[model samples]
Target: MILVTGGAGYIGTHVVRSLIRHGMDVVVYDRRPLPQPLLDGKPFLPVPFVVADLADRQALDETFEKYEFEAVIHLAGDIVVSESVAEPEKYYLNNVGGGMSLLAAMRRYGVMKIVFSSTAALFGLPERVPILEDDPVRPINPYGRTKWMFEQMLDDYDRAYGLKFVSLRYFNASGADSSGLIGEAHDPETHLIPLVLEVPLQKRPYVSIFGTDYDTPDGTAIRDYIHVSDLAEAHVLAVKYLRDASESRCYNLGNGRGHSVREVIATAEEVVGASIRTVETPRRPGDAERLIAGNERIINELSWKPNYNDLNVIVESAWRWHKGQN
Candidate 1:
C-alpha cells in the first residue's frame, strides 16, 4: 500500500486518485479533514484516510505501525511563499521539522522508498531559464529554503542509511483532475490560474497582477505551468523508478515551456470567455523574473510525457473546476 502525506490537499488528492486508478492501494494522511465532496465520487470514496499532522511524532509512528506503507509520497508542508517569509519559524517547524519526524518514522518502520513534492523556488533568481536539477541551490525565501533543506536531508539519509528517494522539484503546479471531481481549493488561493478564474466566477472583482515590469515579452514574470494530473503521473512513474532502481534521483517536472503572466491571463480570458479585470501592483518581494523547468531529464529518465502541455488546456481544466466550485 502507498501512503500519501497531505493527500487531502490540491496536488496530493490528485496523486491519490491517480494511484488508485493505477490499481494501487492508497491511504491519505493529512492534518485537514477530508471534504465529503471528495469522497462522494466513485473510486475515491472507499479509500482510507488518517487525519494527523506530520509534526506529531507519536501520531506518525502510530500510523506507520497501523498500516504497512510500502512507499510514501510526502506532500504535507506549508507552501505559501509570502507566509513563509512572514513566519520563517512556521516553515522551519512544519517543513523541515515535520520532514525529520517523517524520516525518523520511515527509518524505524524500514520503509526505504519515498517521493517528495519539492518546488522550483529552490532555484531562486535563476541564472538561466529552464532551471536544471544541478543548478545552484540558492532559495530566496524560507519556503524554498525549507524545501531545499529537506532535499539535502534526503541526500544525507540516502547516503548514511538505505533510504532511496526521488525529489521532484516541480514548477508551477496548476490545473485540476480532468474529471473535475477534486480541484484546487485553498482558504486564500495564491495560484495564478485559479485566481484569474475567480474573476469570471464573480468570487473576486479583479485579479491582482504582481510585478508588471519584469524583463519578459509582456513585461510580466514568466512561469512554466504543468497540469496536476501530469504531476501525479510523474509521481507514479517516480515510484516505479524507485522500485526498479536503487539510486536516489532528482528531477525538475514542468512543461519545458514558458508563458508570460499576460499570456496566462489572456489564455484564461479566452477559456472563460470573459474579461478578467487586472490591476498592476509592485513586484512582491522575492519575485523572480522568470523560472522555467528543464524537463528533458525526467522525460528521458522516467519516460513521462505531459498530456496537458498547452496553456489553454491548463486554464480550461482549471476553469471547469473553478466553475464547478461555484
Candidate 2:
C-alpha cells in the first residue's frame, strides 16, 4: 500500500485518485478531512484514511504501524508564496518540520521509499532559460527555501539512513482532472491561472497581475504549466523508478514551454469566451522573471509525456471544473 500525505488537498486529491486507479491499495494520511470522493460521494472509491498532521509523531507512528506501506508520497506543505513570505515560521514548521517528522517515522518503520513534492521556486532569478535538474538551487522565498532545505535533508537521509527518494520539482502545476469530479479547490487560492479563473466564476470582478515590468516579451513573468493529472502520473512513475533504482533522483515536471501572464489571461479569455479584467501592480517579493522547465530528463528516463501541453486545453480543463463549481 502507498501512504499519501496530504492526500485530501488539491493536488493530493488528484494524485491519490490516480494512484488508486493504477491498482494500488492506498491509505490517505492528511490533516484535513477526507474529501468527498473518499468520503462517500459521486464516483466514490473507498480508501483507508487518517486525519492527522504530519507533525504529530504519535499519529504518524500509529499510521505506520497499521498500514503496510510500500512507499510514501509526501505532499503535505504550505504552498502559498505570498503567505510564505508573510509567515516564514509557518512554512518552516510545516514544510520542513513536518517533513522531518514523517522521515523519522519512515526511518523507524524501515519504509525507505519517498516521492517528495518539490518546486521550481528553488531557482531565484534563473541564470538559464529552461532550468535543469542540476541547476544552482538558490531559493528566494521561505516556501522555496523550505522545499530546497527538505530536498537537502532527503539527500542527507539517503546517505545516513538508506532511504530511496525521488524529488519532483514541479513548475506551475495547472489544469484539473478531465472528469471534473476532483479539481483545484484550494482554500485561499493563490495560483495565477485559478485566480484569473475567478473572474469568469463571478467570484471576483478582476484578476490581479503582480508584475508588469518583467523582462519577458509581454513584460510579465513566463512559467511552464504542467497539467495536474500529468504531475500525478509523474509521481506514480517516480515511485516506480525509486522502487527499482539504486540512486536518488530529481526531475522537473512541466510542459517544456513558456506562457506569460498576459498570455495566460488571453488564453483564459478565449476559453471562457469573455474578456477578463486585470489590474497590474508591482511584482511580489521573491518573484522571478521567467521560470520554464527543461523536462528532457524525466521524459527520456521515465518515458513521461504530458498529454495536456496547450495553454488553451489547460485553461479549458480548469474552466470546465470551475464552471461546474457554481
Q: Cα deviation of 245 in candidate 1 (Å)?
A: 1.9
Each candidate structure's TM-score, on Cα atoms with residue i matched to residue i, is: 0.97, 0.96
For residues 1-326, could you state the per-residue lDDT of candidate 1 as single tens digits?
A: 99899999999888987897889888889998665564444455357898999988888888899899889999999999988988999999999999999999999999999999999999999999878889898999999999999999999999999799999999999998888778888867898998888888888899998998887878999999999999999999988898867789999999999998899999998888878899999998788998899999999999999999999988888888888878
- Model 2 gets an lDDT of 0.89
At residue 166, what lDDT does model 2 achieve? 94
**Superposed model 1: Cα runs more than 4 Å off:** 38-45
Q: How well is each residue in 88-121 modelled by candidate 2, as lDDT tens digits?
A: 9999999999999999999999999999999998
Give RMSD to native, each candidate. Answer: 1.4, 1.6
lDDT agreement with native, every candidate: 0.90, 0.89
Give the 10-residue window scoring lowest on summed lDDT in candidate 1: 36-45
